[model samples]
Target: MTWAVLLALAGAFCLALGSALQERDAIRAPGASVARIGFLWHLVRRPRWLAGSLAAAAGVCLHLAALSAAPLTIVQPLGVSGLLFAIVLSALFTRRRVRLGQLLAGLAVMAGLAGLVTLFPHSADSPVLPIPVALALTGCVTAVGAAGYLAAHWLPAGARAVLLAVLGGAALGTTSALARVVAARAAADPVSVLDWLTLLAVAVAVFGGLLQQNAYRTGHFAAAYATLLVVDPVVGAGIGVLVLGERVPTTPFDQVLAAGAALLAIAGTAVLARARNRNPEALRPASSPSTDLVHTTPGESS
Candidate 1:
């Protein structure tokens, strides 16, 4: 259990820092919109985005390992604590000072995570969904993603950020739920990791990440990142309950405690998100237009 907690925190750190790096580089990618495949084509070629991708990939591995060792509910909340790491990383990169509000909010997030880990006693449950159910879920995810992507274009900037982030977080959360099942199956049979469900999960994660990139492009990191963190766990928690037969604390005292912890975490997430937004350095792009196009990427001229 201790190892699982450590792994989850480490994964969260990598993910937060990697996302910051990737978003910083992405904003510099020669475009205002992330709708075109050409936008991402340029990002992959950049050295920093590639490094960030590697870090985020490592985060996924660590997160999966933590999921295999503990319940989805237990491990997911800790991911929220990544906001602190993001704050520090943003400060370091932008050369800005961290403010008092951000510090307090970060502590609140940590307290909630500590409470959640201490209260939750459920171990991981092996996921087993019927074939029809899996297909239906897959179809729903695809349809929603398609719809959301189109809808984002029609909406205003602020609304677009929220919509994309919510959809992206939900997709990633669904991936986490599927990963739990895949991880469990892997322990029983290594070859089973390549099954249909596993493939679907991988696909969904990629789709989610693409949406996330679009959200970051909106230049509203607070709305996008905070929404992503909050929605991801909520979606995963729902799936864990509906499909995996997971539940929250049944005892009255524990239930109260859990509710309080959730509130604290949510509040902290919002506060930290707003703080990042106000800080000049959160995800600022390159000052020079020429530097933005310095790299000879795909379909691009240096």
Candidate 2:
């Protein structure tokens, strides 16, 4: 269990680094639409972006290893810490001082994670979802994602971004659950790599990436990111309990503490998302002729 926790934290760190690097490059690409195939072409040629991709791939590999050892409930909430990690990394790389709100948010996230780890009991049972259950879960996630995607186009820019991010998070959560099942099966039988579950997971991941990119393009980075932070774990943890049959403390006091901790983590993310830049120069709007071509701080978007 300790190993699993460490792996999850390591994965979160890598993911945060990757997101910061990629978003830095991604924002520089003008006229790149999420709906078009050319959207990522500009980034593909950039060495820094490529390095970010490699880092993200490493994070995924570590995440899969963590899933193989720990229940999704334990792993998913911990993944929320990635945003906290990103804030610190962004400050360091950008040579900016960390804001008080960002520091407080980080502390809140850590407190929540500590509470969860200390209160949640370890489960030795395998997190294997039967085919029927997995199919049902996939169907539900698809329906919700589709709804959110459609609604995004109908809403105002800020709200649209948040809705799109929520959809992205849902897809990501589903992918995580599917990946866990696939990993478990592969450990038992190597042939499980060829299973439909693996293909579905890949498809969901692709779709989620598209949603996330669209959200980034919407220009309300803080709200979109905060929404993703909250939704991803809620969806993932719900599936963990329902599909994976992971157990949590049933006592009222433990339940309250768990819920409070989750809320604190989410509140921390929201606070960090709204954190203002201490550097006045960093706050200036881009003067580029193309409104689409703008640079954003890593902590603000990714």
Candidate 3:
């Protein structure tokens, strides 16, 4: 594997590690501050959160550097490794088990992602979008993210997880897009240190971190993670094709196979979400069904 691919994989591992640490912290705090606020505060005091954040920062830095060398297609597929890393780390650290369905679903998603990555070329040519266009795109992304954030908060935990996942996914997609722009600029014309991209990179990393933490806090880890994982690649890949003008690998057969894989992933997530919804643990289950439990029967009272 190329250094760029290695760096991208490392970034994914950092993200996975950070998320697992955050989840560990969440389990400890009863009535934890909502994931967003709690994660921000945790970053202030907790050594683990700090370590995780620093790791994430390192990952982002590496990713930025990798973007300098590789295409979004190559870089983005490597990100799916984050979910794998998270699952493995979670099992090692917490002994938390993932369901069979979730595992299969994850595999499906990764397979599709890998296929997509292989199908696209790794050229460094980035489209020269006008500043206004970039700004407009950023605005749209932020608006959608904000709307999802609001919706997550408004709904109960399950729904909240779904919405937060959407937000996290979008945040990631935008981050990757920004990374491409930076890479392209660097590739096309030598730019100085700390340019427009430097600022956007920081924003994307921080915001994505915050929102992703919220995703963990809003609901069960499996469902939230699956949703976020699914959405991020789809969005990123879509942008890569539409905005970056990357060519998809040819052959109708590959396209059909990729679509099937995507469908399996989506179907798996939908099943997981619905199962979570039906399970009593996801919500505040009703109290005892027996009305008489609170008061003695008439005969007993007498």
Off by over 4 Å in 2: 1-11, 32-45, 60-81, 92-97, 128-132, 153-161, 217-230, 276-302
- Per-residue lDDT tens digits for candidate 2, residues 1-302, read 99999999899889878866765554454542233334555567889888978988898788889989998778866775776677666567556776776667767866665566545655656797777777777787778877776655556545556677888889987887788778778888999889889988888887787677666555444445556666665676677787788777789999999889878866765565455543232233333423233223222322
Identify the leading candidate in terms of lDDT.
Answer: 1
The RMSD of every model to the true structure, in order and in angstroms, is 5.8, 5.6, 8.9
Q: Model 3, residue 224: displacement in angstroms?
A: 2.7
**Candidate 2, pairs of clashing residues:** none
* lDDT agreement of model 3 with the native: 0.63
- Choose the strongest candidate by TM-score: 1
What lDDT does the true structure give each of the candidates?
Answer: 0.72, 0.67, 0.63
Clashes of each: 0, 0, 0
- What's the CA error at residue 196 for candidate 2, in Å? 1.0
**Candidate 2 or 3, higher lDDT?**
2
By TM-score, rank the candidates, best first: 1, 2, 3
Q: Residue 171's C-alpha lDDT in candidate 3? A: 76
